[model samples]
Target: MADGVRPMLMRLRRNGVHVGVFLLGAWAWAGGLLPGLLEQWDDIAFLGWQHVELVALSGGAAILVGVPLGILFTRPRFRRAGDIALQVLNVGATIPTLAVLALSMGLLGIGNGSAIFALFVASLLPIVANTMAGLRAVPPPLLEAARGMGLSTRHTLFQVELPNSLFVIYTGIRTALAINVGTVPLAFLIGGGGLGELIFTGIALNELGIMLAGAIPTALLAVLVDFIMAQLQFWTIPRGVNPLR
Candidate 1:
C-alpha cells in the first residue's frame, strides 16, 4: 500500500458511492417506491428536496459552531475547567429536545431559526467533547518539543496539535452527524420542516407511500452524510493511520 495508490482508491470509492446513490434514487422513484412510501403528493417534488435541504442547513450550521468551539476548548488552558465546560455542554445534551424547541419558540419566534438552534445544541456535545479529548490525547512530549522550538501558542495549535488531533475531531463530527439525523426530525414538531412531515402525515392518513417517501430520503441523507464523513476521515488521517484497525 503505497501512499499514491491509497488516494486513488479513495477517489474511486467516493465516486462509487455517488453512483450507488443515483442508482438507488432512480430505482426508488421508478419502482413505485414513492407510492408505497407515505402520501403527500400535493407537493412531492418540492418536499423531497426541502427535506434534504433542512438536514443540510441544520447539520451544516452545527458544524460551523461546534468545530470552532471544539478547536477553542482543546488548548491546555481550557482543560483546567474542562469539567465546567463539559457540564455546560451536558446541559445542552440533557435538556429534552422538545423543551428547547418550546423555549426557542418564545425566544426566536419559530420556523427554521428555532429548529436550527435546537439541532445545533443537540449536535454540540459530541464534537466539543471530542475536540478537547483529541487535543488532550496528543502526546505530551510532542507538545513540549513544539514549545521548546519557540512555537507560539497559536502556531503550535495549528501546526502541531491540530493535525495530530484531527483524527479525534473528525470522529467526533461523524458521531454528531449521526445524532443530527435522528434529532432533526424534531423540527417537524415545530413546523420547521423535514422528512418527519412524511412520517407524521403517513401515520395520520395511513398512507404508506408518503411514509416511505419521507423515510427513504431521510435514511439516504444520513447514509450520504456518513459516507462523506468517512471519506473525510480517511483522507485527512496521515497516510498510514489505520481507519478501523
Candidate 2:
C-alpha cells in the first residue's frame, strides 16, 4: 500500500499543472462563475451519460481490433505485411482526427455511427503500436525459457508474452481513451448527442457559463478515465512485470 501511495504522490507532483487546473476549475464553480450550470443539472447528467457511452463503444471497438492486429504484426509469419500495415496506420493516425470525423460523416452520413467509426479509427494506432512494441520488448530469454519448460506456442503467448506485455498495452488503451474523451465533443457537429451540445451552443452564444458547463465536465471525465485505467493497470499487471510493484 505504501508502494502504491508513493507512486501516486510522485505522479501528482509531476502533474502539478493538472492538479492546479482542476483546483482552479473547482474554485470557479464554487464562486458561481458558471451560474448556468446549476440550472442545467439534468442536461449535464443526460449528456454526460451519452458521452460515456460513446467513449465506451468506440474505445472497446479499438481494443477488440487493435490488440489482435498488433499480435499478428508481431508474428514472424506476418512481419513484412505488418510493417506495411503499421505504416498505413501511422499515416492514418497522423491525419487530424477532425478530418477523420469529417470523412466518416461523409461516408456514414452523420449520427452516432459516424462518430463511433471516427473515434475507433483515431484510437486504433496507439493500441496496435504499443502491443507490437510490448511484445517485442519481452526478453528473448523468457520465450526460450517458456519453450524449454514445454509450453506450446499458444500457451507461451497467453501465459508468458501477454501477461508480461499488459502494462504497455494498458498504457496504449489509456492514451486512446483520453483521446476519445477529448474528441467525442466533435461528434456534436454530426448530430451525435453528448455534452458537446452545451459546449458548442455556449461557444456560438458566447456564454462562459454554458461553455464551462460542458468543458469542465469533459475535462473531469478525462482525468477520471485516466485514473480508472491506471488503477486497472496496477491491479491487472503481473507483479513481476509491473514496475510499480
Candidate 3:
C-alpha cells in the first residue's frame, strides 16, 4: 500500500508542476512581464492555432498508418519481418527531423503539407513500436483461453488483445504527440506557419521578448497536451489491466 501510495503522490506532484508552469507562463504573458510579447498576442494566438493543427493532422496520420501496420506485423506470417521493419523505422527515427523536413520540402514544396508529412514520419515509430509491444504483452493464457472459447481471430483481437493493449498503445501515442508538439516549432523553416515563425524571427531580429512569446507558449502547449494524454490514458485503460494504476 505504501509503495502504491508513493507512486500516486509522485504523479500528483508532477501534474502540479506542469499546471504551475503553464499558469506562470500565462500570467507572465498577460501581465506584460515581457514588453514586446503583449503587442504580438494576436500573432502568437494565430501561430498557436497553426501549431496545434499541424500536430493534430500529423498525429492522426501516424495513428492511422502505425496502428494497422503494427497489428499486421504481429501476425505469425509477418513476425519474422517485424525486426527488419523496426530497424527501418529506427533509421527513420535516428535521422534529423530537420533533414526529413528538408527532403519533404524538395518533394512536396514548402508549406504545411511538407511539414505535416515530415511530422507524420517522425511520429510513426513510437506508435508502431508501442503497438507491437502492447500486442505482444497480452498474456499467452488469455489468448489460449480465447482460442479455447472458439472465438474468431477478429473477435479475439478486438475483444481480448486490443482491449488489454490499450494502455501500452496509448503510451506510444502520448509519446508521439509530445514529439510532434516539440517538432512543430521547426515547421517555420519550410513556411509551415507555426510558433516557430516567431521564434526564428526573434532570433533574426535579436528580440528576446519576441522569442519568449513564442517559446513559452510552445513549452506550455507540450506540457498541456501531455497532461491531457495522461488523463486519457488513466480513464481509457481498463481497470486492473493498468498495473501502475
Over 1-245, each residue of candidate 3 has an lDDT whose tens digit, in order, gives: 99999999999999999999999988876877655777889999999999999999999999999999999988888998987897887787889989988999999999899999999999999999999999998999999999999999999999899989989899999999999999999989998988999899889999888888899899999999999999988887778787658
Cα lDDT over the full model 3: 0.91
Best by lDDT: 2
Q: Write the per-residue lDDT of candidate 1 for residues 1-245, one digit (tens) a residue.
A: 69999999999999999999999978977987755653555545566566667667767887788777877766567765776887888777778877877887778886888887777777778888888778878898988999999999999988888888888889888888888887666688887887788778877889777667677677777898899999888877776443553
Better of 1 and 3 by TM-score: 3
Compared with the true structure, all predictions reach lDDT values of: 0.78, 0.92, 0.91
Quantify how close model 3 is to the true structure by its C-alpha RMSD in Å: 4.5
| Ranked candidates (TM-score, high to low) | 2, 3, 1
Number of the top TM-score candidate: 2
Per-residue CA lDDT of candidate 2, range 1-245, in tens?
Answer: 99999999999887997889899988877888756687878889999999999999999999999999999999989999888987887787789988989999999998999999999999998999989889988899999999999999899999999999999999999999999999999999987888999899999999888888899899999999999999999998989889988
RMSD of each: 5.8, 4.7, 4.5
**Could you tell me every candidate's TM-score relative to the true structure?**
0.78, 0.88, 0.86
Question: Each candidate: how many clashes?
Answer: 11, 0, 0
Name model 1 segments beyond 4 Å from true.
1-44, 240-245
TM match of model 3 to true structure: 0.86
